[model samples]
Target: MRPSGNAVPAARRPLAALDEPVRVEYRTVHGYRRAFLRAGSGPVLLLVHGIGDSADTWRDLIPVLARDHTVIAPDLLGHGRSDKPRADYSVAAYANAMRDLLGILDVDRVTLVGHSLGGGVAMQFAYQYPERVERLVLVSTGGVGRDVNPVLRLVSLPYMDQLMHLLRLPTTKVVGRVGAAAVRRLPLDLGYDVDDLLRIFEALPDAQSRSAVTRTLRAVVDWRGQVVTMLDRCYLARAVPTLLVWGRHDTIVPVDHAFVAHAAMPGSRLEVFEGSGHFPHHCEPARFLGVLQEFLAATQPAGHDTDAWRRLLRYGRGDGATDAGAHLADQALAQSHRTAT
Candidate 1:
């Protein structure tokens, strides 16, 4: 699909040294400027980044994936180059923004790929507009369970705004960088995630960005863990081709959540990267790309059937039971797995 007239090219930048330069563009949606990276041409692949991240998070994969498919990676509102105005930072709201952005670009259907918080937004989008999604790819996705990193939980607490303001101070920034460097030197799984985590931390130095992060975090997390979950609606994944990729060493969102989510979503494929942490795609780009390409080649793009969707929504996979029953079963299974782990 062609981008609409209002889709203005912002600036051109090379995604990587080995890759062709990709165009970063802007389109005003609802009076807010939205930034996105659009490259190559074919069937569309919409790549959504995690919280506190921009479209550039997928820079390595974008060049490779663009060779075979059009890749559209947008910086979610309140992140990266996008306008960070005070607004609804909930997953549902982010999903709506994606829908609007896609519509503006005249994209009808997409193979949706989301990471971290973006995964929750993608699932919500599929739930709200199943007809527009051809497939789903979730990477270390949140909203699968009540388990999340304590750092995020702390960020969701009150007074974090003031605390984050302090993070912007030069002395604190230097200390943070030094601490991160020190952590990376340790023999721990967390070292794999230090750079990525530090990037996210550095991005939140400003008040608006920090507030956005806090609001987004609080929407899905609390002092304990993730407050929202997709287990109840995972049965709907039966209609859509789904792939779940996780790092076996992921400390931010436990790898167990991947197993639980895989079980909850029937027919979903799960790949665990042994040496990686939260950001498997970044840590193991080659294998991640291979698995993604294989999945895309093997599965047929799902066609939306209004009647079938309605039935699935009403009868829960047509197994002679309501979705409520399926939800309970999923919860029990998830609980059992959590306990066993």
Candidate 2:
């Protein structure tokens, strides 16, 4: 069913108009309010943002995608305008929350597009509820490798919560803004990422937000690096249309993880944005939307086959063979361990 909303005419509008404002809506689930942006009317496309970001991250792309599809971008629990509380901030929990939110909105299945932490959530959602996902678009996704930014590893360390408290000081905030401004002027790859990084940094000052971010980070990461790896299950991508997008110069998650993940997931498409950082969608909105639209047009949505899913679970690739899948799984794990050490 199409999402019930006033449809914006596609003809009169430019494809990626940043001036367009997508209204925010709220729905109460499990005693907390969840904020989301819903627009357009066609097949469902759910956009999940990375950690410390709100639904507003997709502001520029929403108007473009909404012209042809029903787009739903939700601020995951404990972030954005959504209520942040002491709760389970694990990837699996966030996946379940997406399920409930979509159910409430009467969306049964979706072409899921996720970035960074949200990409990990998309993978977990696809794994947990395969029937509910039609396609997967992982952009600078986590859980594919062990190497992450040292800063994130530090954030996952114990007692970082108190340090976050110190960052909330007025003088500290001013200094941070100035630093971010200076970074934007530098000739560095991080210059493209500083704004989003600054937003995440700004959010950390809140007590509840700090706890939420800390718990979320610790769930999939540690002082060593990322602990969760999806390589073992990459074979499942054969049953679903998967697209992997990454910035060639991503320092936070590293672009190498994209190649590793692409190698593991058979038939998955990979697009590396040159001169882009962690936020490729923001860095190259036109190219990002073009690649996405092309993928959508070329590939048909995956229909959930219950028996096929069961076979894939039991036999790895539903080909009655476990050796190849097992080998790939082992290789992925070994690579992760090697990186961690």
Best by TM-score: 1
Off by over 4 Å in 1: 1-19, 317-329, 332-341
Error of 2 at 81 (Å): 1.2
lDDT of 2: 0.81
TM-score of each: 0.89, 0.88
For candidate 2, the per-residue lDDT at 65 reads 88
RMSDs, each prediction?
Answer: 6.7, 6.1
- TM-score of decoy 1: 0.89
Off by over 4 Å in 2: 1-21, 317-330, 335-341
Name the top lDDT candidate. Answer: 1
Cα lDDT of model 1 by residue, 1-341, tens digit? 31222221122122334464578999999999999999989999999988888887886568788888999999999888899988988888998999999999999999999999989888988988889999999999988778788888988899988988988899998998899889979998888787778777766647888888788788788887887777777677677999999998898999988877777777788899997899888777778888999999999999988888888878765563345545654764454222100
lDDT value, residue 265 of candidate 1: 77
